[model samples]
Target: MPAPFTADTVTVHSPATSANLGPGYDSFGLALSRYDRVRARVRSAGLNVRVSGAGADELALDEAHLVVRAMRAAFDRIGAQPPGLELDCHNDIPHGRGMGSSAAAIVSGIELARSLSDDGRARLSDAEALALATELEGHPDNVAACLLGGLSISWLADGRGAAARAATAEQLAATGIRPVLFIPAEQSATRAARALLPEQVPHADAAFNAGRAGLLVLALTSRPDLLLTATEDRLHQGYRAAAMPASAALITALRSRGMAAVISGAGSSVLALALADQAGAAAELTPVGWECARLEVSSGARTSGA
Candidate 1:
């Protein structure tokens, strides 16, 4: 039999994530400082949900809510489910625009479920939790980084999600790397952006991305000078450029100014890997009506009141 719920309330703070990072498509991801906070409580008979901040107006308040769905999935995996749930979501990450908002929600839900169960941590190991989150999110890059923090490299192993942290928080802080984001008012859907790619890319382009992806690991961890070259990608960005013309043009312009820049994820947001001296210049390039923010690399999701 499964262990009963021991905690009446649980809170999870999940970080936003940026995937692809230019050349490591579907493999590399970085956690950003922005976060979404969810507080879940057990109830005797009814479900209640409240939302504030980003997506508050449009997001569903019932069982159809993404966080609720993820919590239910985690409860199923743990062999138990609470009678009812009350959720309070305070969101900071924007919806869509390739910022890993979905991944954050999924991660938060799984963590909440685990925290509420007396033996949930024992039943669901970290690897199992990650796999469950990946299953719910349909990809590992964003969820892996949101769960593990810093720089993460994820892949599929035996049809399950597997990930490892490439750069430690200390290493990243020492490099003084700042991620400057330029977010457009318009959002781009990941499905639409993915459909723009061809079934097969040229061998030469594949080789190019492989080389750059490897260099990206080194550049992000140690050699900051190589970032411009390391961030180069020919596999997916060009193919999806038409879907986010403004983003593509902004990346081109940033690179021309000797800064390392690339499309954040699928598109419509640009990420520039800037140093302390370069962050200001990168922000200045943000076009009118676009939102710009400079953020630091963040730690993984945190939980309280478990």
Candidate 2:
């Protein structure tokens, strides 16, 4: 097939993702409607990034940026010399809040590379994109969700384990899932949240997380009522409670009310998986100092131009 790029410019809209999804720590993810839009084109002889929205002033505008790094990685993988690039980033995903901003940026870059290169007369395939994005992000949860949309189940495995590091996404048949996000004013770094987890969890806790994670898949597919139980986590959240007390508190409060609430990705932002009909109910429970939004599951990444 001919490459998708026929002009100098390519634009990609990559969705922000919420990973972990409660008990499925580091393994499950869901792509939200929110996104970061990136536009790239051949320009000059150097890399330049222009940013607007979320991290405009704080994020770098040079080649060292995550987007540039990912684009370069994609080029290197395909044995193509990267071109002089101009990147425009209109970011809506919040930084350092476990909303997969980095993952979105990485996917954006990889898609940009695929759109720009045609050295082998081939465009990037979904598997190639996922593999490269996973390589750059070191995990597939968020990246897979950003690339494939809906819900993603990912794992890294040794030969003896379940499966080698791989990711896949699915669109659920059950459609009433309404995601209400409670984004706090303060941001929590993913690294800091991860540091709070112990090297290993208790065996029973692991079993509990495993069971709930399995149940979660079922609940998400058909039984909305089971979400409260399915979303229970005995793995990562409590260990990192101190890192984002407000998020922890909000989660507790919602769950106590029989709502399926969880810390989105890591912390600082909470997600209440409510039924579409219960959107107003979830909105009514939004706590102070947090921005709330009702979001749907995004179909997937969309690329256009050239």
How do all models score by TM-score? 0.98, 0.91
Show where candidate 2 strays beyond 4 Å: 1-6, 119-124, 157-174
Q: Write the per-residue lDDT of candidate 2 for residues 1-120, one digit (tens) a residue.
A: 233233468899999888888998988888889999999886546777899999888998897889999988887776765547889999999898889999999989888888777642
TM value for model 2: 0.91
Model 1 quality (TM-score): 0.98
Best candidate according to TM-score:
1
lDDT of each: 0.91, 0.81
- lDDT per residue, candidate 1, 3-111, as tens digits? 3885467899999899999999999999998999999888776789999998999999999999999999999999988888889999999888788999999999999
lDDT winner: 1
188, model 1: CA deviation in Å? 0.7
Q: What is the lDDT of residue 173 in candidate 1?
A: 75
